[model samples]
Target chain A: MSTIEIAGKTLELDADGNLANLSDWNEDVARELAKGEGIEELTDRHWQVINYMRKVYQENGDAPSIRKLTKESGVDTKELYSLFPKGPAKKSAKIAGLPKPKGCI
Target chain B: MAEPIEKVSIVISHGSLEGVYPGLIMANGARMEGIEATVFFTFFGLDAIIDKRMDNLGVATVGNPAMRMPGGIKMPTWLGAIPGMSRFATYMMKKEMEKLDIPPVREFIEMIHDAGGEIYACKATVDMFHLSENDFCSSLDEIITVGEFYEKSAGAKIIFT
Candidate 1:
């Protein structure tokens, strides 16, 4: 595993440089991304999508598109954003422990 | 935004004659752009997969105003329920496609298959709808569930019409 500090918070990632949060990412990372700082709470649905995204990144070596993620996880895009607030893949991906996906920036 | 890579996997969940065409058209368009494409047919969308009915498809009329001629006239949704509507819609769509130099649905399917695109049927939808493999085109890749489709769609873009 490795770690990288974005803003003031240090994020722990796996060997493949994936998001290490897995299914437990509350809003800490999300708050960090959204407010460009830190967070305190996250929902179960957030963890579900983050974990699924991590799995997908591992297998495909890339982040799944929002549409694919929604279809796979059966989560609506609106619900996904409500959880992330800033953006689903951007903040969620960071907390999930994934490297910055190409084409997203 | 990054130009989407040509490696997109598209899952189409429509089976109506008109509805089914979008799936095929987009799949073929993806291939034309050299993107990896896949089409999953579920529910009534299987009508396109069924070899017997593929050649005959219909247009959307219910609450749909685009079902008119070049003059942009209005037509009834119930008109699509008529016997000949399917055939007429099929012909009209084909004609418009030909005018645009787009391939016919059959040819488009074949092109997609030959170009390494995938075609699948929804197993649950088939079971629920009382459809069998024989009802679909012989070129199908598999009869999969939504989960399988999701897995396949991973890392790819999805366009739903």
Candidate 2:
């Protein structure tokens, strides 16, 4: 079991990726998570991925892959590249406040 | 690994539609990194956030050499406003979005708001343009002055693109 605190609520991530504290998650948590990722300012496009990721994680209890993110979020791969400039997985996941993704290092 | 710098706030000011997207794109990028992002629309830039003309924006071809056809056929600035040209350019942009599979501007703005980010309109520009609050896009949180905007964006990065 693993523990994470988002927006002042404690959450648990089991081996299967289930959230024990789903009610604690909210847009404010996403904002705080974004803040921790170094996003002090925000834009409409940024929210697109953050919101989608939160929804996907809450539903599937598993993080989205880059391909799944693009498909589900409806943001173009090129535009995603342009938005992240660094690369989608690392940067986007960081801002979305998800845990460090696998295979990112 | 190197440690990361703290979040930086970026301010984007633009009037033209073509010019505005860069600001939007950059601001979105910054937000993804948890950086502070603010966009200030003045004069023509205000037109972009305003409801009346956001969907129907013009392009800049006068000085852009890269904006050419397959064989480097440069487009003229005068042609940008030639009746159907604005619509054509808008359509071309939409087509590009379709090709990239990016969402529309409306959806993008909604995403920002849902994430608890802020969107503000320029008070002075709004007054100068004779646009009431009702004329602005529904996503706007408030109408603020340059000074107010500066205060909010201070202590963060600033970008004018």
Candidate 3:
């Protein structure tokens, strides 16, 4: 476990560097995490995926896989990779304040 | 930390349903992990890229000792030789994979292609099988010679399945 300051709040990060507490997530924290992931600018498209991932986690207790995200999140695979860059499944989940997805897609 | 895999080149050498899925799954998994993937379909594995037969791929129930009944019960080898056994086995496997959200071969190929993974057919195999470029799915990037395959594999880990 490690802690980092985001938007003036000290937040604990899990082993994968996701927010340890989903309740700790906010728009500001997301921007900070996005920057850390090299997404210097989080556009509306990025927020669309981030919100969808967070919603899926809230209902299913886990983030959606890349396939699921592409199939249902209104974003396709190429765009997902472009939006999140390397490792869309893991990187998006981390930015969405969710655990790393477990299974291979 | 382990060094990340930047690129992977997979060679699929067999044509059976079991033969093809490993290469497809691995290539797709590599792209999901942000690694660049190139799939080379060669020899009998060309069946996977051929539009006419790709969707109908079946496990060879006969001679496959690992074959099992629907509920994991061991099946007698002789039963696998029945005319429809291969098709039946393929149907069952597809249903099970669907429950896990894995797509069919056609969709899987499209997914990998749409995600920017490269798919190619082997030139030697294509000629031997009497297949033209038109015989393959649109997702096939090109029909490449072995030398071209090696060129793409340069600096990348090569996996043969």
Fraction of the reference Cα-Cα interface contacts (below 8 Å) that each candidate reproduces = 0.00, 0.00, 0.63
For candidate 3, the clash count comes to 0
Task: List where candidate 2 sits over 4 angstroms from the true fold.
Answer: A1-105, B1-13, B62-65, B76-82
Candidate 1: clashing residue pairs, number:
15
Candidate 1, residues B104-150, lDDT tens digits: the string is: 55656755665567898888988997887777776788988889988
Task: Tell me the whole-model lDDT of each prediction, alpha carbons only.
Answer: 0.65, 0.62, 0.88
Error of 1 at B144 (Å): 1.0
Query: In order, what are the TM-scores of chain A for the candidates?
Result: 0.63, 0.58, 0.95
Estimate, for each residue in B54-106, the C-alpha lDDT of model 3 and write its tens digit. Answer: 99899889887888998889888899998899889999888888877788888
**Candidate 3 residue-wise lDDT, A11-99, digit = tens:** 99888778899899888888889899899999899899999998988898878766788899998988988898777888888888788
- Select the stronger candidate by lDDT from 1 and 2: 1
TM-score of 2: 0.58
* Candidate 3 chain B: worst-modelled 10 consecutive residues by lDDT: B96-105
Q: Across residues B1-161, which tens digit of lDDT does each residue of candidate 2 receive?
A: 88564334334455555777776666555555445556666667776767877766666545665665425577776655467765566677778755553445655554444333467788887888788889888778889988898788767656666
